[model samples]
Target: MSTKFNTFILTALASSSSFGLTPAASALPPVTAISGYSFTRSGMDLNYVAIEFDAAVLPFEVQAFVSKLGGCLAVPENGTDNFNAAISLVLIDTGAPEDNAAWLGIVHTPAGDGELHWSTIEGDSVYFLAFDKGGSSNSPEAPLGVALDAHSQQWFDVTLDDGSSNIRRAVLSFPASMLDCDADMIPDALVLALGLGEDQDGDGRLDWCAPAGDFNGDGIIGAADLSIMLANWGLGGETDLDADGTTGASDLAMLLAGWQQ
Candidate 1:
């Protein structure tokens, strides 16, 4: 929603709920270095998780209502009521503000303490989810209990947990459908698609994707891959290894880093 970081921090201190330090139900899956992507924006270098996969690859929360099928939400912990009502999970798609989807961590507001609350981000609007237990009384005045299936949580700790930032991170479970940020049939689980190409269609699958540096798709990153990276130097097509629209020193560094991988 809004990038009001300063106001958010102040409100969080005075808000009804604070689940930032709540322990996760379980440990999360480990993310290998090559399994995710990292980029810098607004002076922040976020190394978040992104990949493509099948519906069965990871366990997902299911519900009769399509809205709750495969998404993520944060709630209160046992005996504690205070929770962060708004958590914006930002997805970096196409490296553009409009293209990225906000999904986690980024909070806009806190409803209150101990009360379970949720939010949904459509095109550009933010709405809270309200339930009425199959009746016609679903409204903010009469909120219903939301079903949250926690397959696992608290899988990893933030190396950034130095108290400078008042937030912690965990790999929460979600329906594989959420991974399909573009709403395409293909799940964007291309863990190795880092800097592979534009992925112009934003269809969750990579374009001209090979192993991180496997240009020729020979299943290995070797001399052939190096040749390809150099051949297309200063270009912006398939060999744009960094996906920043250019193939140059950084791209060469990327290719060389993966030599014989």
Candidate 2:
């Protein structure tokens, strides 16, 4: 699709749309910190992060996926429309050694407002279709939609394009509700693992017990275990095995080879 930049900025409104929030054009959402993962680029160019929303999040409007090449796109406080036919999602290039390409896909609901959107990092070429509700005949566009199986997780591959020397970084964002929690009940071991209470193991034993406090899977909870836990400290995908957010020696020793005893 030909690249055309539009300057029309709309005010934020709490419309019936599920995507939510429309930040002022001048402002964007803060860069999200994705724990346990790192993004690096070989060249001096920039990388990008894209987000896809679940249809349940915005039940009233036609669902569309948006990509922000280098950063995040802020949803305006007021609702915004993606089918306006004038505005296109913005693309940012970090100037890495490799070219930047990405994909955004939206799945429509059979009868409800629950659609699913996904994004993949592509190189230099991306396409999307503009669809209107009520299923009317529309212009056949090259970027409208591609043949895909929504049921498969392997629909796209993340790799460098052939003959391209540029390398870029990418990130993904989804609503918190998308995650399925552990049976709606936080496990005690997980809780203690996350550092939420004095009960180190949830096994009714004090942390001083040889078997209870050894978190690093090591045979003992000594200074070595403490060092390991301190190395992986943080939340959102790190080794919060106990489900608490902090990392301490207790968590470290749990990694010891035979600490379970």
Candidate 3:
């Protein structure tokens, strides 16, 4: 199916209108960086990386994204313990302007044995699969194989050559895409939170590094100043604040705190 069709199906599965369960504004959980991993030489081995998230209700689009990347559950022979593999994330839809579903990006080393995976449906659980040896050259005695489930998220392990082993573990948090704030989701908020633009507040100021809206300096946000931020919003132009994917209350609050004292 086309990316658009896949997104539509995911949206239908999640019941698009039921966004009430998510807070209009909330704090993102501390993101644990994917570690103990490195990219491969040809940039194809998935190894060492791990990703975990809340699976209570999976987002359809996110699930399709993971499925498109192609997941595998690797199993090794008796002696080896570390199993390694990698999946590529090259396809992205980047939905419409007003639609929050289009924002998608992959954040992991693409070449090594470290890999991350998730589903689009909410309420489901997050799964993990890792490998230790994934180079192009394989010994005739290598005992590594993987199994993948397209429907349900399950745990699987891959064995390596040295009699060592690894197990896939599930996580307990929602993916960035599932977060709903000011009509946008986590991806947008993350972009803003990262300070990627010069005019984060969209107030026409080119230098957003000053305290144009950050009131407390603690970095936590409030709504009073954000009330002044609804004027300008979009891409490429100046008036886009908060970078939370749109020019709305959430972005406003982020800029309001940075507003000049």
- Best candidate per TM-score, number? 1
Compute the lDDT for candidate 3.
Answer: 0.27
Clashes of 2: 48
Give each model's whole-structure lDDT. 0.32, 0.26, 0.27
Per-residue error for 127 in candidate 3, Å, reads 14
Clash number for model 3? 59
How does model 2 fare in lDDT?
Answer: 0.26
> Which regions of candidate 2 deviate over 4 angstroms?
1-101, 105-171, 174-253, 258-261
Candidate 3: stretches off by over 4 Å:
1-163, 166-246
Winner of 1 and 3 under TM-score: 1
Best first by TM-score, ranked = 1, 3, 2
The TM-score of candidate 2 is 0.21
TM-score of each: 0.29, 0.21, 0.22
Leading candidate by lDDT: 1
Q: lDDT by residue for model 2 over 132-187, one digit each (tens)?
A: 33332222221121111112211122211122312112222222211112211112
- TM-score, prediction 3: 0.22
The global Cα lDDT (0 to 1) of model 1 is: 0.32
